[model samples]
Target chain A: MAVTAEEILATYEELSEIEAQFDDVETDIIRHQYNLSKDLYVKREKIVSKIEHFWPLVFEQAPMDIDEFIQPSDSQIILGALKSIDVKRFEIDTPVEGGDPRSVSIRFEFNENEYFENKVLEKKFWWRHGKDGFVGYVSEPVDIKWKAGKDLTNGLLSLAKAAWEEEQTASKKEGKEKKELTPKQKELKEKLDAEAATGAESFFCFFGFIGERVSAEENIEALKKEAEDRKKRQAGEKVEDDDEEMKEDEDDEDWEDEEDLDIFPQGDTIAMAIADDLWPNALKYFTQAQESDDLSDDEDDEDEEGDEEEEDGDKPSKKHKACAHGCKH
Target chain B: MAVTAEEILATYEELSEIEAQFDDVETDIIRHQYNLSKDLYVKREKIVSKIEHFWPLVFEQAPMDIDEFIQPSDSQIILGALKSIDVKRFEIDTPVEGGDPRSVSIRFEFNENEYFENKVLEKKFWWRHGKDGFVGYVSEPVDIKWKAGKDLTNGLLSLAKAAWEEEQTASKKEGKEKKELTPKQKELKEKLDAEAATGAESFFCFFGFIGERVSAEENIEALKKEAEDRKKRQAGEKVEDDDEEMKEDEDDEDWEDEEDLDIFPQGDTIAMAIADDLWPNALKYFTQAQESDDLSDDEDDEDEEGDEEEEDGDKPSKKHKACAHGCKH
Candidate 1:
């Protein structure tokens, strides 16, 4: 009963069909759940907003997926002046065809403090089906207007902002034009990179997150047509120029080089954690805040020096201390 | 903006209502997805069953959640005799009210083997909403009548099965009568406990999994009534016998001692990992078998001795080797 390569290939074909069906079922579930939970989430927002310091406390006790990214500086701003947070499936209610109901926008509201001047920051992620048959969130950079010398990312956000502007400009050009960094931009990027190598990033760097470094509209139609042709080929229909397709796949792999330059490489994961877990379960985290406070208090003596340890041991000691202080705000 | 204890309680009340709504939405989504995917899964099963050694390969490449539980001895039985595996939402289509749609029955079809007499071992887990507001799967033991000297559980399953039978008899008796273990049974339990303390238990013990050691019907009505009364109290309606309710809660903590005696303490988690992840994604795992085979080949030299290490290092080495040999079968 030795399975030949042909048999394995056939099995793969059958399984691919099943996988497609599973994907469709998942997509339907996401859309249906989005529509069903929309109003309830709206109501949830209204209720949670009534409680003071709710958003800050939720962030303080957020799961490691998000908590790992928040720097001590980020916590200072969050605990001090953070007002509220909201997450919305921005495309769910839209009538536009091809708009994904799973796409979300996370909005953070803050009070005036010794930080950025903006009262609101909203970051949107588009649920995308990639040409390579991979599906995930794709996002563009959302610029944060930082006050002079108040940049929490230590110039990384500013450098990334400049690069994003260049990308936007390049995207507007006739072809996929690559831009050369200005000398000043290069200097800033080098300094930021060196600094980033030594320390954890400020969570505010999430705003400057331009995931994948790929344009949303770039060759999308061509990619869709390619995918369609490949699906047809798999169904036993004769397809031409598979060698050319192979070459294109090789070209796609070159995107890895570009991805290496992303300032916040895990932006998509962090965003998902916030949108899916932190936001939806905010109330649970908010309630657990008191329990965590008590737990942290027990370790307070050890935690002061514990903050200087490696990332795994650096469990946001200062934030909890600041939170303990802010508990009386 | 200091949050008072009363304010925190108020916040908890508001959030609990939102959580209930979220739960309902989740239930609806689960039911809807189950119905939608039923036919597709049936079609998938037909296609997969036609392939030889599919189940064996899938078991070899399962996720760590499942792979960790499988002993080398268990793998021998699985890879040699396991023909197919099926998982169904058994109660999803039931017309009866209060039948949870999430309840699942996992069936493992086997060919004639030295391990047990049963041709098909099916374990059903009920989706239960506990009195403590925790929702999870609850299951009773499914007896596997093993041949003498061929038992992989090292006599643990036999002891547990006897205990389960006694408990079932006790459950049928009047006034929650407690069953006293026979002298032999007590001696066997102590031997098995000593053996388990020194080494990892076999995956075959899963068949003896009597999760939570509580009857499914026990106190369910009373618990529901208590929950309702608590809700009424939360909504500012006075409920009688508050002191009695507190005493009942205190008494419930006694169940922890009962839970400690479970032979397979992680049975619920293992069952969920299989049903939710391994079974649904069997084809993915089957395809991944060849890839893991290649990866494990690089480590095969060290893995021979690695098998004798602690549980973390004691991954199923012989299983993969057996799979590699069976690849040509």
Candidate 2:
């Protein structure tokens, strides 16, 4: 299920194997690009709020005796420096030439396509460090950068792990035919695995958030409305293409055997049957959802700007709508 | 921030630690319980849907063998299960009876004090494995059984390795701060650990419907609300009691401060300041809002029954309403 912490780590491990596709990375160094899409600003406040609300539960502050490095892993999709890195226990401060140095520099390399493209975050280290017990500057905010491909791999992995946890808790009735993965499922998972191998953001959210969680969100009707238009994903009970082909061949035969002589109308019968066909593929609605989220990723940036903005520095719109169509980063 | 999967895992770990303190041996076992929660179900569906949607992706099958665990660990999570039992594939339907099969049991063991106990779950030969399929109905449904002071060592630890994934993920983020458990959280965690050790269930929802994927008939919001409340499980945060000596010291400071603010207006100012102190204890109001979500949980259930007797589950007046003194559960 990859729901546990181990699976998340494993997912990241998978993402690490596919780092060549998403972001820019060079050798072992992460090019730490502030890849905030234009719309990310709109959701910045909410993202930050959600993160701040939960982060304290994970990282507690301790007095640090040495300088430390803290940054989101390549698999992480952090919004701001606060959420992206942990500076609570770090004695990381430096004297600014003329201003407070809450800034860090980054260099990006995208699969030998682009290498060491440098970027710096300014006024980032603006928090009082309870650990170091000093109000100073972070001369060098540790640069934890990654190639885009790796970012996607890791993000996808983290999402996959999240999905796994969701599944474990769902409580599938035991002995209820633990369904095997179809070839399409295998490929989706394989692609997920590939993304994980490269340390990039995972598209598995389509699986996690959409596949499992959406049913509970009360948006079924709205989502169902999009089902007809959303067919990028597949139907259920399909193990492989051969099975699907065989099933298609037998569909007509099965159709003829079931009350064909003026007893019941074929339209209603077909509708019910289509609904049955849609049950397994119901989650595929998330694929289009992902695309829609992608589209809104760009649209939301404009809206996110309406809510709040990262006061530190404006990042180029790299904000991928977690769910939207026309989503180009 | 326990915002990421790692953070969430750490939170659960901390909760487990808090659950520990009830009874020494009982709580210890809970620390070993397995918690797959949600990922597997979503993945299984996601993979299947992807397979169905993109039947083209499935070029060929693995040549269906009843015994073969094809792609045993395609996403690595399945591999984790295989690794735990020390086999890539093992037959469950071979039908062994009365071996005390362990399913994914999430137990929370408690002492007479009524505080939280331990929670244990794992993957092993649970009672859910029927001869044919789900309807075979060989055993009783999973029950949250707890014996007085029972040692849950083996049961809790059965799937400890799988839970380790969750634990490690949480530890990764939390280790950077507060230095893991403060010996107190660990004490609390044992209560949950004990449940894992002692109690066993028939069938494991092993990563079932942790979250709602999608529902054509039901509202997504309703499903989401269900998932959220069910997941809530009402695990309380561990609170550290003040030392008696420390309490005395605080009393002494109060008296000293009174002496310092001898003037009337100055004393009033001091009193206001004292009242306004939002530092340590004051922060609790804003931190992790202990809002009652039980109300939201039942909102859907009532709607479903349309005023049926199922509303008995929504007994907020009896349990969670605080009885006007804020003593709600």
Candidate 3:
């Protein structure tokens, strides 16, 4: 039998209610799992800290989702000065209302390196419900204090940061109005756009990630309004402004397209890969590195054991040894 | 500092213990989610049974993972007589020991159709821990009992079943010995192998899925013995028969390669897509179908509403209507 449009729409509304329940249960599961993993992660950190070259090796064997962003220069910096990495669901125990337990913070500690001044850099992602009826993690732009001529992002981060600041300033001055850029700003923006088109930014540019192009507070408010509107519609109330709603949807789609052209277009995906896959499976990655190294050693007929003592003595040799084995470093 | 091979090996052992703990937690989470979804799924089935063309429309919008296996002929059968589909975690509430809560059974109910004798065809997949240290679902070949000259699998299933029965008989008589096929059996086997090489089979061949070459009982016993051996090795006890173990590993690899050459090589993946993704997300797929249909109606400038009454009266027109919109049917 042919299904009427009305029946389809009604069924969709019913399904949406069921989906919402499923989503709630999923959130609860995540919150519980996050709490359970906390102590285990702490135990893991203690065991991993004493292991030499742990972080570098883990990064080297990271899955393609995360590895694709790491440039040779980025690998050099990582192999040379990257000390350790930590991931935590920072909001899991938060007592604050509206806090999402799934929001995570990824911390990278580095030794004295040529890249940046900061010894510890932490990037926090806030899991929020989007206005477009999707849930994802959003993050603010993190400023990395790069040393002179040591920016692995090739000045793209600085350019993006400036443009973001200008956008923020303009938004504050004139709500929801597009701001015209000055000549210098326009030139910098053009250069940034061109660099973004190439899509070969360093992994360090992950620090400059600003997902969603909107603040958390603004997103939460918009989602709340949308929810209220949905409830009103469900209660058999006619929602006016259909044309305005269509225009808003089109605008949102355009913004999403623009977001896709950013340097770190898949920032959320990368963040998820790091937080979910790379961090939890670090030990597996480390083991994989060891296994691959062993295979290559056998193939090359190299005395890697004899070189181990030299690697322990000189830090530079460790980098060289990794590079000799076809590592990006 | 350079990590020694001993240290890497020791770390891997420690990490494996941590991973096992994580797995336990994951299993518990899945059990809880499964129980919670049971009632919701029941409610969904009740609602869906009243909707016309529900199963066909949902299948039409299925993701590529599942859709890729479905042939045009399979689509015709589905759109013609498929009444409803149901997925259940059959082993979840089983009182038997070693019952896995994750094991699922997918049931497809059909109206009086030209394909098969049975009104309902159910395929069950058992979630098990493999001897190779990976956990996956395994299923036995399900008999479709197709009507004469109406077999969708083109006699492939029948040939496979006969070959499997012969293997079983041979194994019973001469434990682990290679089975020899009869001259007539060899011809059928050659035809089956050729069909498998083409990598084009009816979706009905999913009923003939036997995921792992080894029986579940054998796998479980092997895993238990391996675990015991690992414990002994960790305690500095030398286990002999290194060459035998290497040979067994090679044999297992060969078996895996042979399994990959089957008609439904990705049976586990397809089963997962059905149970986890397609079944749970049926409402989403149905909505997608309706939305896509609306878009096509607008593009074609056709009065789908005027034709709806005719579709309600005639079953074949529903298939024609779907085909008109570029569906495989």
Candidate 4:
């Protein structure tokens, strides 16, 4: 039996009502979450500003090289420090003026990964909208091969890298199942992929500005392109009617499935670093500074240790000496 | 120390970049999920349409009353069958010509529920968006007081009703936590809540149509109003700056959180009912129809029992007689 037009109309009306209900509720929930995250970001920013004030002074005075601080090596505890060398670009992708961009992001990746074995953090910056501005989220680390003959120094990184490399090779040998596409469609898809790959690479070339960061104008242009390219990709997904790009970004999708709207990016790395690795030393420094005001006691245990190590000769390297002296001036 | 304007801009830009990256990836994931859900909805709809073809015929001829089919009373197993009485109306909310409506919902609820204790199934049709139109979802029963002297038939309902009534009285006595709000805001909130409550109550007055269903125009207008009301409430939540509405529609939020873009509301009650309660009888009917072709055997023991009971001078009541006959057509 043929379905009546009336039945179709009735069904449509009901569906609209439901959609209205859900959209209204969801929008409110997301906005509320955003506001909460924003408030948190402000609190975090204050701590970060204080760290920024002191970090340069500490780096200048401490008997340790900049390379040691930035290297992706084990420090006897956590995996390693992940740093954002620079904000290569950013943009809000929304057509409506003043409408909050549902999609906001920043792009940055590890500038050096000499210690990493199995994977490299992708050069692409992952981001999410936060209350004050955009916040950075960690994208899944991309699998990679070591530059031939590069030595691995971190045990955990070596193990994970080897496993990932093995998986990659096996998968490559098995190959993707081929689907027949018209030459024109295949060419267009290849073009789009190549453009995206090229964009990702040139997005943060370090030598272009002769050791200085890219100018603000260049950064803004890059941000615009990133937004435009993403828009194009979305359009492509809808049009391709094919399945090539379907397999791309599966990890990112899985991550999204596991997370909720409340999972905003916490963009203050200085605050994160202070919490993660610097708190103990910072507390010790403050305690000593306060005690020294009342009386000069035997609070210079680290300095004494450094002096003893120095008497034992050049065997105690700068890093060891810095550690012994508590890297405090 | 003070934060420089440049430093703030740099931080904001970095944050924006990270957010952009995440938003792009998430949007792609959600769109993919939506496409998958749409496909599933289409497949489910085909199966439902086939079931719809035969159900009305069976219900017309079968020895069960419409009331028996729709009532919220337990028979042998399972919750009572809640169904769509009709797809009463539909309209696109968008003003743009031929633009699909953002809101469409079917109205339906359980016809009766004397068995529920703490809650009763309110006569409100909960709806979901369907691929081609609208689908009805089962709403939980509402709470009600029985007319002062109504007899309770179901033991479970009686127990629940008493407990719910007690809770209501206690809460009413306790009073709500006071919040400071402008008199105008307070009045507006009260107006909105009262409107929503009233809409919930009369949304499904079956007798108002005088045995016929409500007109499509009325349903369309009602849907428009519901959509408008929801939008206003969301605005209210933002303005009220209070937590009063924070607890509202938590279930809907949980449902949204649980479901992905691939989640579409399945709208066919005929399909739901057949799967739930009618399968055994339907199978038996098909099997008997096949057997009667080969031989005329008095295989229906229940039908024979029904004949005997009828001859015994009105001893078996209507319900018992129906049960004896297997309620078969």
Candidate 5:
């Protein structure tokens, strides 16, 4: 039996309602993520400030090298029970009075369970110019324990997946009933897929924050290698045909990364995007990326343009580093 | 024992955390509200279009006046099961070809549960400029049912009140322990109180919607009456002292409405405001409003300016009307 266009519209409406139901859950999870992120920031800043202050006072009476004095082992008593760590290094961009520019390394330890799933026990240790002996600070805005990013992400993904499945089932039923779908129905189906895809991607992108940029960079590196192989093949080098097939697989994965990066270049929480009624806006982005894929002949130039932007102070993202005093790897 | 500034800051942070936990529930409630508002808009449009089409062809031979044909009883049969009603009147702003510009009256009905809480069974009826009879149309974007605004509000208010109580108890305990409070502690206490007040106000403002605006208008009217009495007293006119005392009670109530209207002048979903990190922004608005109130000796001129803005079509809100067909008052 052929379904009427009106029926298609109804199906579209039903699909939207399903998606909208997830809006609440998605928003909740995002809020949780935001709170955690904010806590991390405050904790980091407080510890960093303390380390800065602790350095000058301790060295006032004893003339010791700032770099050597701050070691992980030296601060082992101060740091107490160790937790997960994020290490960071900073350089003095310009030396005061033309003195040689110096650098420092810092280590941040969060309570294993707390850092991973709860908001408790965050410690920061700092070592200047070397990774060793450390001094620590305890930060504020603390809590006993709360749900971690992973837990929130899992919850978000569950709701999002359910929404996607509901929409997909409705869309599939419409397609099976009607041998040929109306243009509007076809459009609706495409939009439902986009919404679902973006919904899932949002969770993945948000929770996997630092990982996403790293993956995109990795994808580009793989693409560059693949391009080199193609050039070698064209130059009549004896490259195995099996190598070409592997390259093709890598190409598909690269496209996924590219689409992910393009969809959320700035890496904003997907929950916020959905809350702002931005599905249509996100669809527009997907459309642009799809068009760009069709015009892949210009890929090299596009990569070159991205490189230029990076050179113009467009860093991939701000990385949160764990400062550990004195234990050089 | 006096509470130190550090202790005060800790209290403030705790209060914020309490409110932040409500963010998820509030967002859920707001999303529900958005869905209801969207449904209302869609249903109204569908019914109006149906009535417009139904009128012309059915009475072409008799050629009766449109207003005369549309009656409440006629639409009553077509609309059948009445649930709840929202009435509206539409006027042709411009007369076509210099003829008399006509108007129409429309009545919307939803299932009683549907209207307030459920999102089911919405039907619309309308009578032309000449209401002799009425015709009906079932609207689009239909759903079986949904959670009502009242339930959402009640749930929100419950959580908000809990958060408020917890913070209040904490603050009081600290105050009791420390007989004297530092200036910073005083400021923190004030801010926590403000957050609690705003949180409660947000839920009330959202649920009250149009009623809030009406209340604000009513407050202004009362304020004007109180001012008139004050002027009479200054002029040595015979004004009853008891009347002046009664007016003071009304004056305080009016001030509350005035503050509410000022704080959320747009009547936006408070949940969204918080999610967007707009609490600080809203606080800034409150401060500015307080300053304005202090400089409000020239309030009459401000009212006149507001009237001019309204005349210039600067009314910030869209107004809905009550439509009456064959029913007498």
Candidate 6:
């Protein structure tokens, strides 16, 4: 049977759900790959479209939306990788636009102005605060300034809103299915819950040696500033200028988008980037001079400058004579 | 009890004696970690360093030297990872630097041209002879190119030399102390060796698929150019020409090290880029305000805004909402 574009669209949504929220990492990934490969070659071209249009982008950041809170994916805990790159983001030069769920970036103002620098780190929503008398972690924050701009990543928001709607609708439709409990049991449950919720100590403290957590916001700000300055100086060669141009171009693109844009093909940036990174070493084989000719001449080619290495039982060469005035070669 | 660097180094040299090669996926990175952790911070720090420095500088458009070969690590594959970054180069960079004898980076290449562009598709090194088939892999070029820049990294070549000596000496000592084998057994061993050598086609091909296998150099280069251009275009603003005065003014700070310009940091550029990529989400967390706080201020603070999330239940109005409609209270 012909797999329609509609089925691919449905599959995309289903696969995204399985990938993002489905709790089992391996299972979700397997399901995602299976779906991807099933129509792998067939709808391959459309994935790029989906990614390009994944705007009014949805970002995963901050405390769960109330619905997500009540029934969070168990897998969400493991995915709390504190550090993750939206690998796709590196590949696309799309302007930073606004209006998406979890699109916040953090800006920490140091309590001590010594750490202050005009810097911004654009990223997803996150939180960190000190709790205990002993300082440890002053959590990093996620800023949401992007939304104030042209508000383009709304597609991501609508997706979140739709999920929210489903959560709300699900809550409404399938509720009242709870069993009636005795007063004593309810009392015990509430007490347990209260104790859990009201636990005095906070875990977010930036713990380490003493004074490490003190004015951690300042320290973090200082580090962030340092990091930010370092980047601007490095990419400063062209980034800021490019950033403005990119944003303007995006605004122009948005003018043409007229609110609705297709997303399937664009989502395949992940696929495209993968293809790009893997083909090089593969190419060496195709590009090599016939080994019968080349490999024969180069069997012991490594014995010259300074790097001598060992392979299994064979010695490639003592070619790198710099390792202590070597003459044994 | 003393753990001086020299003693620790000597102990590490001895440890490689029992370290037989494995042809399976790593069930334990901890083991490699434990073995290579003589310079724990050094090793871990080097992973990022290897990625930042040697990758772009040496391997990006370099030719294969054919003399370098890496013993596979526990997970000897980074087959389709050319999309964002290639962990495949792990072996060459690690060995080239000789940071850790136990651990090796998976082999990866930039297609001599293609780097991170496609979503990983096929990563196998093959040659259509138009006559004879299947040219073997020669990672020597990557190693040679990688080594060419070793002086830029600290003591990495020295460490590699140390490892080579340790391995060579250990192998020699073992050979000297070995027991004699019977003629039939010797013949069997010889046969096995030939078979193992003969059996390497699949192994190398597998390596081609897993590690060295990659896309065309042109494809990756084009993709990178496209990605970089797109990135610039997405983020590009019209560059205002810098006034020579302002450029000179910024240059006025003239640090003493600037005089010693030859030793300026190379890895710092990619390092900053990496940190740039990592900083966004961290920034967001620091910026978002607590939605629960606002809800509590509006009504009773004690209810905790329906923390249970009422899974499969009615949507409670009091439920906590985070980052909604521009982080509205």
Which scores better on lDDT, 1 or 6?
Answer: 1
Candidate 1 clashing pairs, residues 3+ apart or interchain: A1-B329, A329-B1
Scored by TM against the true chain B, the candidates give 0.79, 0.14, 0.80, 0.23, 0.19, 0.17
Local distance difference test scores for all models = 0.66, 0.25, 0.66, 0.29, 0.29, 0.25
Residue B291 of candidate 3: its Cα lDDT?
55
CA error at residue A305 for candidate 2, angstroms: 46
Model 2 CA deviation exceeding 4 Å by range:
A1-147, A152-184, A191-208, A212-329, B1-329
Q: Per-residue error at B109 for model 6, in Å?
A: 26
Task: Give per-residue CA lDDT, model 6, range B113-134, as digits (tens).
Answer: 2222323322212211000111
lDDT tens readout by residue for model 1, B1-329: 67787665555555555666776897799889889989998988887887878899988877776788888989999999999888888788664334567778899999999888989999887766444333556677777878988888777777777766765565455343334554444655676669867787888778767654334553365346646855874687644433345446645343223554567866877788888778876755664565455546665554543433222221211111112112311
lDDT digits (tens) for residues B1-329 of candidate 3: 68787665566455555655665676787788888777888878877787788899989888877889899989998998899998888777673345567788999999998888889989888876554433567777677778889888888777766656665665577554443554434655577777767766899888877766546685567557556755765675543424335456645333223453354656777888888778877866775576567656664655665345322321110121122212221
Q: Candidate 6, residues A1-329: lDDT per residue as tens digits?
A: 36576543343233222222211232233233333333322232232122221110111211122113212321232123122112222111232222111112222211111211223322222111111111112112222122333222222322322332343354345443432333332343344345445433111110100111223343344335433533543443321213334334434322122111111111122122222221111111111212222334665864533132122101111111111111112
Name the docking class for model 1: acceptable
CAPRI accuracy category, model 4: incorrect
lDDT (Cα) of model 5: 0.29
For model 3 chain A, the run of ten residues with the poorest summed lDDT: A313-322
Interface RMSD of each: 10.9, 30.8, 12.8, 26.3, 26.4, 24.7
- Candidate achieving the largest DockQ: 1
What are the per-residue Cα lDDT tens digits for candidate 1 across A186-277? 65567666986788877887887765443455336534654575587467664343344534664634322455456786787888888777
lDDT of 5 by residue, B1-329 (tens): 36576554343333223233333343344444333334444443343233222222121211121223334433332234333333222213222321111111223344343213432332211111111011111111112222454342333333333433443355546632423433433443454456656453322212221112122233345435534644654454543324334434444332222222222222222222222222212222222232343335455656554434323211111110000010000
User: Candidate 4: how many backbone clashes?
Assistant: 44
Best candidate, TM-score-wise?
Answer: 1
The residue-level lDDT of candidate 6 at B300 comes to 56
Global lDDT for candidate 4?
0.29
Candidate 4 chain A worst ten-residue window by lDDT: A203-212
The TM-score of predicted model 3 comes to 0.78
Q: Which consecutive 10 residues in model 1 chain B have the weakest lDDT in total?
A: B316-325
After superposition, which runs of candidate 6 have C-alpha atoms over 4 Å from their true positions? Answer: A22-249, A253-329, B1-329
